[model samples]
Target chain A: MKKLWISLTYLVFIVLLIIPLIRIFSGSWAEGWEGFVEALTRPQSLHALWMTTIIVVSVTLLNTIFGVMLALYLVRATWLGKRLKQLLNSLVDLPFAVSPVIGGLMIVLILGPNTIMGVFFEDIGFKVVYALPGMILATLFVTFPLMVREVMPVLQEIGTQQEEAASTLGAYSWYTFWKVTWPSIRWGVIYGVVLTVARSMGEFGAVLVVSGNIMNKTQTATTLVYQDVENFNVLAANSVALVLAAVSVGLLLLMEWAKKRKGH
Target chain B: MHIEVSNLNKHFGDFHAVRDVSFTIEKGRLIGLLGPSGGGKTSILRMLAGLESPTSGDIVFHGKKVNELPPQERGIGFVFQNYALFKHMTVYDNIAFGLKVKKQSKDQIRERVMSLVELTGLKGFEHRYPHQLSGGQRQRVAFARALAPEPQLLLLDEPFAAIDAKIRHELRTWLKDMIERLGITSIFVTHDQDEAIEVADEIMIINKGRLEQKGSPWDIYKNPQTQFVASFIGESTIVEDVSKLKGFEDASVWPGTKALIRPEYIEVGKRSEFRIASATEPGRVKHIHFRGSEWMVEVTVGDTTLITYRSLEKEVLQPGDEVSVLVHRAYLFNDNDSWIMENKLKEDPMPIHI
Candidate 1:
């Protein structure tokens, strides 16, 4: 009886998940692969793909480094006061609760045209909103928590004994970290970066609120999909959406592999 | 290197860990920091290893102050209670890590690591990861890894505390042999007095962050200088009130002084055979325990019970048998807890009031 119930629940979950994925794939190729190829080949769509890749990759790289350092400081270093550390730890989860659009609006409120930061940037001949930087900032704000949350528990689990052992063995601080500490936390970093990449790739609400949806420039893959559907280019929209879904699935698979590799 | 810990004190917030402790250790001797749990033995070891800073004292090494030195620059090898072997690395890599960090050539690192693995009895398991090895094997790996850089001083924090009980004695003997062969100045912390007595060239007994005594195993065992050391270092019967002893009233020992008599020093026989010449006390044998070559007889006298070891050659003593105990040697400590002297009860009891 238990086995039958478990199998029924598993079937329902798989069916619920797989039906949309099948519809997505077949709907994107409804007009045949030729139309799919042609829509993807359009210059604007091509530029959006490139822009999305650039933003996601840069965000993943920067967030991976920052996440590991922040997790290390939180777990191992004692530079902050107790209350400040707790506050910072709490703030690490801000992106989790806040909507992506509101995060983008927050950036705008601080760096938009009327604000002091916006005026300073404008005087310096730099643009934050309606630019590639604005989209990147939105993606960064949405994906910042992925890496830190993944690495913090792993760092706490490994503890400082190995690091202390390394130091007592005459290893300098950096050498001890790179040698003794990094190997233990490498899987966690990989898992974090993978999540960060996937989240940044699919981030839409924040990028839409900040980048102004400029074509051939600030328009990312997600925004381009929206623009294609608005202009009645259904095939173009489906093609870009399918590609984004595939990339996200690929990242999800990588994350699963990393999680398995770091099993208890 | 010779090490000196002078007036070393450490405070963690409001808790005092190590008090005003001073000791000088000679070079190339294996010393044991023996104490009860939470007695600050480990803290003193950490202070010497530079893992912790003394709040108000200096640690001098070879006549130079080392209080400001980091653990790495202090050149000390430390083995933690958990071993703390690198879980991700094989035995070879873990042992070779320090030499590699020192930028030694590949061949030199391999040579040094192989020699250490051989020395530590880890030659057959160099490729095994820490998690893959047994507790004893992992402990040896931790020791090898710590010794790879040729540290001047070696500190072990309860190195055998985590191992199986059956293997503890084996490791203790092996470690004593290894340390003596290397001739390194080493100090290890342990709460087990037996391990300290068997393994260390000298034992420093600590209690409540205070130094109770420091002497050789023979000296400390035979003549513990304080009540705490005497009671802690050996299995002895402590008579709280010396006035209760049958002949102790005339020995110039005061009312509240405590006398420690080792089980081997107390002779047991039938009550009728006990003469009044010696300090003979009558008691009922409450229990009899077989200790291989000897019988451990617990006798209840007055309001206290004392453990005495009798040879197997004697007649078997039952639980309800009445027996008299003769004290051949007893060390008396005053109410102030300092050693007074060793008293040998004689056949002719004389009045000695001084």
Candidate 2:
């Protein structure tokens, strides 16, 4: 009975994962290596890839800093009242609850060029909507919870005893955090960063809505793939997706390594 | 450094953890905050270490008020329960953390850390992480780490609670000797009565967030001022209506009082062996426990059960056997105060004959 169940699971996994991955890998090289190179070297394709890299780097950095800070505040800040902490804690999972498309729409509505804050920013000579900033913001919205969720449990697990021990040893708060707290949570932060990077790389609905899928100005890798699919350019879309899938697989491996280190 | 705390109170929301606790410690004295769990002994220790602020009180060290001072400025060494060693850093780095934070030169840090490592008996294990070391080794590293910065005082919260029984006993003696040799005023919190009595120069008993008593172990054992102290300080059984027991008939004058009988105060022996057999009450052995070095025999005289320890040199006692039990002393206490009551038969060992 157990063998039958195990075989059933393997069948489902191969059908759902291995088959699709193989199809994409073969589809990307339908025109051979020269055609694949040609598809990826187009100015629009290169720009989209570059934009994705910029978004991934910016989002990962911002998310790591802010997410870790928020997790620490939620777990360690005694000044926050119980109700307020609970409210803020639930608010952290908002990105996971709301659809990314709706998240992008909310940002556009709140910070679009016609809005008061948007016009004020434009008056100061900074473009937000349908630009690099908006694309980054959209990806940030979808990936914010990934880092926080990964780091929050780690912060909670380490507790405040070591920090207290450090303080009583004549170390200041900042020194205690860097010496005692940072080393303990670094693995968790690394895991969070990997998740955030992967999420930002593959973010599609939000970035498309916010970036307006501009060919060179703000189009990201996933958005360019969407545009190609919409225009019946299956080969181009497959080529870009193959790159995303490869990076995601690498991040998965990195995440597993981080998880093992954190177990120690 | 001499330390004084006055009217210290701590409240976690509506729950009062420490209430009106006041005490003073002389310089170089090793004090023990001894109490049951959740009795606020740790709260008092943390407040002294500046880890927790008192709700309303003043902590004065060397005649300087430090209620507003942070733990870093207070210059205290705190050893947490379970050691709380830095798992990531090697033993050497863990000990050098405070020195590095104080901006000591690398040479000075190395010099201090090496000496501490030697003092703590962790000489060869400097490069191992906390997880790689045993519980006792980790505790020593915590001690060395705390001592590296040369703090004015030291605080340990349940220092031996995480170690095994044998190691705990060894560490207790080692810690007591080390603290005395260094002449560093230290305070440790422990729920184990044996640990506190055996190691502390003075033990402060805490109960229900209040300071019950503070004295030398022997002094507290001989003279317990409060009912709580009388019952808490040793292995005792609280017996009501003490006047019902033989030789305690005069105790009836203190109505509504309870008597605490410690095992050492009661002697159980064979009827033929006791010289004062007339004064000794006949009791039935209800249960016998084989302690490592002694036999703990429980005897029931009339309706009351009394506990007494018997020597292994004497004839073995068995359950359901008839024996003569003579209680030399028992502490009688009411709600507010306590006093010792001696067996009146002891005054007249030989009875008058007609």
Candidate 3:
């Protein structure tokens, strides 16, 4: 019975993931690669790719640095600040709790053109609600948890022993941070960065409200897929979804490779 | 290297883990930081190594105060109990870590590491991970890594306690010889009195975060400075209200007192001198076992237990038999039950091995 259950589970898994991917793959070529080629070569598609690359890189880098510092702060801080740190730790996961559409609405309410905060932001010469800036903000908001969640657990497991040991060994704080602390968390950081990149790449609803879907400025692949689907362009939509799927697979492979390297 | 520790105190929150620990070590002696778990022996060692800061006091090494100096600059070698070898590195790289940290040249690091590998009998096992080696070999690798820094002082915390019995026995002798060859001042911490005696030139027995006694191994074993040390070091029988014997110094004796005497000093045979009143009340011998060279006889003396080791050639004293025990070599303590003093060697007591 146990064996039968395991076999049935594997069957279900294959039917769900592999079968759908096969359908997408078949549909992808049914249009003779013309849809994929057209999608890739079009100005809108290139702009979307450019926007995604810029947003993912910026969000991932900023999130990783801030997240690492947050983890280090929470673990090392003492006294009253530790309690505040504990509260902040739980608060960092707030993005996961809210619905993506609610997340979009929240960003719109706070940063849209009609709000006082939005007016102030615009007066400061930063266009947050309907531009590349808002897209980056939404991407950063949804994906900020990845890097901290990754590096924090590794830091907790390794404990402060090696850091203390290095300090006593005469490595100054920065040297110790770079050599000992960083090396131990390097694989986890990379894994987290890959997760952030993937998450930022596929971010849609929140970004959609803020990006205004500018054709050559702020439409990401996820938003492109959504817009193309709405327009009843099934081939273009399927091709964009296929590209997103391919990116997810590539990032997932990177994660697995990181895990293997960590094991070594 | 000479080390002077003054009023070193360490606390973890409300707990006074190490309190006012002060000791001085003459150069080139193997000192044992002897204590049970949680006695803060490791904490003191860490403070000396600059791994942990003392809440108070200072450690002076070679006439330079190093309480604030970082561990890497302390010029002290540390061997962790579980042998904290770098799992990612082979034996060769593990030993060479300190040198690499110091930015030594490649050839120099190789030569130093290889020589240590040879010295530690790890010549053929240089490429093995710490997990791949035997426990004893892993311990040796830890020692080799420690020595690679060419440290003036070395520290080992329960270094042999993790190995299997046979391996422990083998490594203890080899390690002692190796340390002696290096002639580096060292301190080894262990709970087992036997291990401390085997390796330490001087032993400091600690209890309840306080130093119970500190002396040469023979001195501490022969005449422990405290009842705790006496009981901890050797198997002994404590009898109180014996009505203080005439000549012994029971330091706090007003009318009567107790005595701490080891089992080996007691002779169980027909001695015409003293009356063996409690011992002769015939109870069944109950259990008799040959202990390789001698017979371990458990004779009940009234409501108490007395252990006696008799010769193998003697007629087996079985259960339900009569026996006599004569207490001779004894270390008497005061009424408050703390250690006062110990008897001197009138004559080298026979088979007086502790």
Interface RMSD list for the candidates: 0.8, 0.8, 2.9
Fnat of every candidate, listed in order: 0.79, 0.90, 0.24
Question: Of the candidates numbered 1 and 3, which has the greater lDDT value?
Answer: 1
Q: Write the per-residue lDDT of candidate 2 for residues A157-190, one digit (tens) a residue.
A: 9899999888887777788878888988999999
Using TM-score as the measure, the top candidate is 2
Residue A131 lDDT (model 2): 92
Ranking by lDDT: 2, 1, 3
The DockQ score of candidate 2 comes to: 0.80
Task: List model 1 lDDT by residue over B1-354, tens digit each.
Answer: 999888999998789999999999999999999999999999999889888888998899999999999998998999999988888899999999889989999999989999998899887898998888999998999999889999999999999999999999899999999999999999999999889999999999999999989999999887788888888977888777655666566545366667787887777887665555356777789999998888999988788788888878877889998778776667787767565443345455766567
Each candidate structure's TM-score, on Cα atoms with residue i matched to residue i, is 0.93, 0.95, 0.86
In model 2, state the lDDT of residue A155.
Answer: 85
Model 3, which residues run further than 4 Å from truth? A1-23, A26-30, A66-92, A100-129, A156-186, B244-257, B271-286, B332-354
Candidate 1: which pairs clash?
Answer: none
**Tens digit of lDDT per residue, candidate 3, span B1-354?**
999988989887788888888889999899998988999998898888887789999899999999888887888888887776656568887787778788999999999999998898888999888789988888888888888878899988788878899889889889889888888999988988898898888999888778888899899988787778888897787766433322233434545556676778665554342353432223335467788999877766555566668787766777666656554556656646544333332234453467
Which of 2 and 3 is ahead in lDDT?
2
